[model samples]
Target: MSAPTYIYKLVSFSSPVPDPLPEKLPLSELDVASGFIHMSTPLQVPRTLKRFFAEDPRIYILRVKYSTVEKNIKWEDSKGEVPGEVGAEGMFAHIYNRGLGTTEIESVAIWERNRDWDEPLKKAESWLVY
Candidate 1:
């Protein structure tokens, strides 16, 4: 299959993403430590959240155009503790040498941690560029 047109960045609700969004987004602790930004494909967002951000009360799923960050992105093997979890093709997108910027973002959708989780998952699916 062809690469997705877009990728998703999950931001903690604690970090306020401005209404107009900013040129550069603050890196998550994991991102800072890892030296690259973690991102997921459209179909990978829900599982990513469940695995990594399950404790977060809310999350901001930033829809970003793949073209904008294509040069900086590396399709690397699963680097997390658990191998292959939430990884598509056993690889995930990792952005290096720069932070995620506003120019790439198409939209931002808020997903709260709901009891069933399905509602938020559906909302996230709807926000994806497909």
Candidate 2:
């Protein structure tokens, strides 16, 4: 299948996301320590939640227009922190050189992490801008 036109971001914070999100999102702890913002494709979001956010009650999902942030994104291998870890074996998008901006986001949604995290992502195509 062709690559998606958008990339997705799952954040584990409780504050309501500001409209038009801040030009430079306060980088997550990992993102700050690593010096890059971590992002995934639509199909990768659910697994990401299950692997890294299972304990969180809810997470925010950001649908980012790929072309808008293409210059800053790098596709790199993520072989988990160790091995045999779920959701950490593919090439993921990492934003470097600058912080993510609203100009690149198409929309933002919240997912209540539960037994059904993967349901909405099954309709990933519908999340495309057009």
| Residue pairs with clashing backbones, model 2 | none
Clashes of each: 0, 0
| Candidate 2 Cα lDDT to native | 0.69
Q: Please write out the lDDT profile of model 2 over residues 29-93, one tens digit for every residue.
A: 78878777888876676678788877777778888887787787667655323222222347687
Q: Per-prediction RMSD in angstroms?
A: 3.1, 4.6
TM-score of every candidate? 0.86, 0.77
Which is the leading candidate under TM-score? 1
Model 2: per-residue Cα lDDT at residue 47: 72
For model 2 the local lDDT of residue 46 reads: 65
Candidate 1, residues 45-106, lDDT tens digits: the string is: 76788887888888888888888888887777647333342235767888889887678888
Give the poorly placed runs of model 2, Cα more than 4 Å off: 79-89, 119-125, 128-130
Output the number of the lDDT-best candidate: 1
